[model samples]
Structures are given as structure tokens and as C-alpha cells.
Target: MAGPVTAAVLVIGDEILSGRTKDRNIGYIAEYLTAIGVDVREVRVVPDIEEEIVAAVNALRVRYSYVFTTGGIGPTHDDITADSVAKAFGVAIDVDPRARAMLLEYIKPEDLNEARLRMARIPAGAELVPNPVSRAPGFWIGNVIVMAGVPTIMQAMLDQVAPKLQTGVRMLSETVRADAREGDVGGPLGAIAQVNPEVSIGSYPFMADDGRPNTNLVVRGRDPAKVAAAVAQVRAMVEGLRKPG
Candidate 1:
């Protein structure tokens, strides 16, 4: 695909990997990125360990056009995303002046203690990502964009970051239904996909009126005309198969 802006999501936190918290960030970010024409290529969930975070950050940042990390940047003891990311790039971690000033605007001095100042600590040479609801900001180092784990905070941060990103062609999808089973449609769908390589064809089976299984054919692609053409071809093939036999 031309001008494809691929991204990877790094979900850092022991709560997520251990199943203590169900991750809602990945789906939200994926939908948001898709809407803006950025394709989410991969997602990795890492624990609160520094080594894991650093490794994931290093790996994803190099592979994708953008790497977005959520969680572990909080004010808690387990919040090590910033330090780990800094270590990944061999940069010093310190309280950024701008971030500190921003935090000071909202939080009291007592609130900005050691535990809280940890939120202000950012990797050197990184640009700050503004958090509108909360003053504590996320930071971007190289291709990696680190944001909060909380759904609301992450959404706010994304709103600020989305406008700055380079986006690709938005993907469009269409669906067609058939009385045929998934197995019956799979072969034809695969053939159609091969013929229209640009379009992605997916066959989903569901219970029909007679308690028999039927298939739903979904076609998605960057080009609307290509997707439509593929869907029409698949529909015609299914209709022809349903004739008098």
C-alpha cells in the first residue's frame, strides 16, 4: 500500500498481562487509528518490568511507522514505562522543565512530591504530549508516542496527537450474505480475493432460518471501487450457485 502509516501498540502493566485489568486501550486506539487511516500492525502486552518494556519499545519503534505505548506511566510504584523507554534509547530520565511547569499549574506543591514528580520525569530530547484533562503529559521519543493507560486520558492524548500524524488512504468495507455455508463460500472467496488482490475477503458463517449455517462475505480495501467490484463478483457467484440445483 502506498503511504501506509503502520503502527504498533505497546500495553505496559502487570495488571493487563496478569488479567487483573481487561485492556480497553488497544481496541480504542485501533479504531481511532483506522478512522484516521493509520493501520495498526501489531499489539504487545508487557508487564511492569523494565526489561520487557524497553525491549518492546525498541522492537516496535524500529518496525512500525509509529509506536504507541499505554499504561505504566502513572504515579504508582509500578509505573516504569518512561524509565524503560529512556533506557531503550540510552537517554537520561529526568523531570522535564516544561512538564514540571505544566504539572505545577494544576497540582499543589505537596501533590507534586517525589511519587508525583515521577509523572513529570521524561526521556531527554523527547517532545511532550499534552494531557488536556490532567496536566501530567505523555512524551514522544523518536517514533514512539507514550500515553496514559486510562481510557479517558488515552483518548484525550490521542485527540491531541492524531492531527499531527501522517495518515494513509482510509479503508472501506462492504458485506454480502449468502444461503451457502462458510465451507461452500470459502473457496470462491479465496478465488475472488486472489483475482482482486487489493481487496480483503472474509467469510463468516451464521445460523440460517432453517437452522442450517449460512455465510456472510465481507470485502474490505483501500479503494472503494475495488471493494465494490469484488463484492459484486462474490454476490454473483453465490447467486449463480443458488440457481435451480
Candidate 2:
């Protein structure tokens, strides 16, 4: 890649905003893309409105290397993501023969109702994203990729789309768990972070399953050497701050 590979996610659904549907695709997509070396820098959620979808899609597609949208591709009338994506690219849309064929693999010819065929409508000049879970394929035009909102179906589409994306260096991470509190180590951790500008350092305090308070210090960077070096300092700091029982 010529530059850092980056992406953004656009989540579309009134149900999600209304709390009727809890979103599960964003975190999965983020982790999946990160593992493949594509940094997900931003995420936006919009209602079922066509204008909002268009605005989010257009903005994110230009700002990132890839923009993946989840939801609004079902048989119901509220599924307007396809048309909104088309509007974003200023392209005309129609029921694609190939998409209809995919649906036929799942739906019997006699059962292929008009509502079901609505899933086949795709933007002009866009390529189809195969949906192994359901036959209703998503489509992509330019840098924007549209996928189903359902986690399983969206994951299947991501697997299909992954090979086509341009990836970057995978980030390296190191975690050091200490029997310490965040406030007890925040000062030294902050100093370590200042010296290691290349790596990101964080301190997380949580109640362990055993009901004891503990801290986890994490270091992340594209360079393994830097991550290792920074984490070494983190371990040293934790050890030096240890209290005698």
C-alpha cells in the first residue's frame, strides 16, 4: 500500500437507533479489519433515512480506503441501504440478474415474490458481495461496501470482501497484567508513554473474576521492537511499584 490502510463503518437502521436492535457488527468488523492490518478510524450510525445514509456513505468513502455499511438490505420496506448507496455514488439501480440468480439458489422460483426480488436491486457499475448466510447479496461501488446488518451474514460478506482490500502492517500488542491498581501506576505509565511515542500505552483497572481489583497495562504499535521495548519498561515500572505484604 502507498499509505496507511484505513477504513470506516456506517451502520444504518432505525431499529438500532431506537434500541429495538442491538448492533453486533461494528465490533466484529473492527477487530476483523484490524487483524488484517486495515485500521478502522471511525464509525457512524444513521437511521433508515435515505438522506442520512447518503451523507454518511459519501463522506466516509472519500475519507477512508474502504467504507463498510451494515444493515438495511432485507425484504422489508425499511431496507433502503441499497438505494441510498446508489444515491451516494449518483448511480442508477435495478434488480441485477446475477443477484436474482443467487436468490434463486435459496428461494424457489415460484416463491420468488416481488418483495423478495427487491433484494436483487444493485447500483450500476457495482460488484456484488456474496451472502453465504442468506442469498440477498450486498454490493459495492468505489470504496464503499454494503453488507447485511445481521452479524452472521455480515461476517460472511466480509470474508468474501477481504481478499479484494488493500491491507497494511499488522499491529503488534503486548499486555502485562499486574496485581496493582491503575491509580497506583498511572504516573509511571504516563511517563513511559511519553518516552515511547511510537507505541500506544494504556492502563485498565477491572475487578477480576475472583473479585480482586487489578490492572492490565497494554502496549500496541506497528513495530514489534518498539512494542517489546515499551512493554519491558511497563513491566519494570510495575515491578518497582510492587508493595511488600
Best by TM-score: 2
lDDT per model vs. reference: 0.90, 0.92
TM-score of candidate 1 to 2 decimals:
0.92
lDDT string, candidate 1, 116-169, tens digits: 899999999999999998889999889999999999999999999998888999
Per-residue lDDT tens digits for candidate 2, residues 29-128, read 9999989999999999999999999999988888999999999999889899999999989999999999999999999999999899999999999999
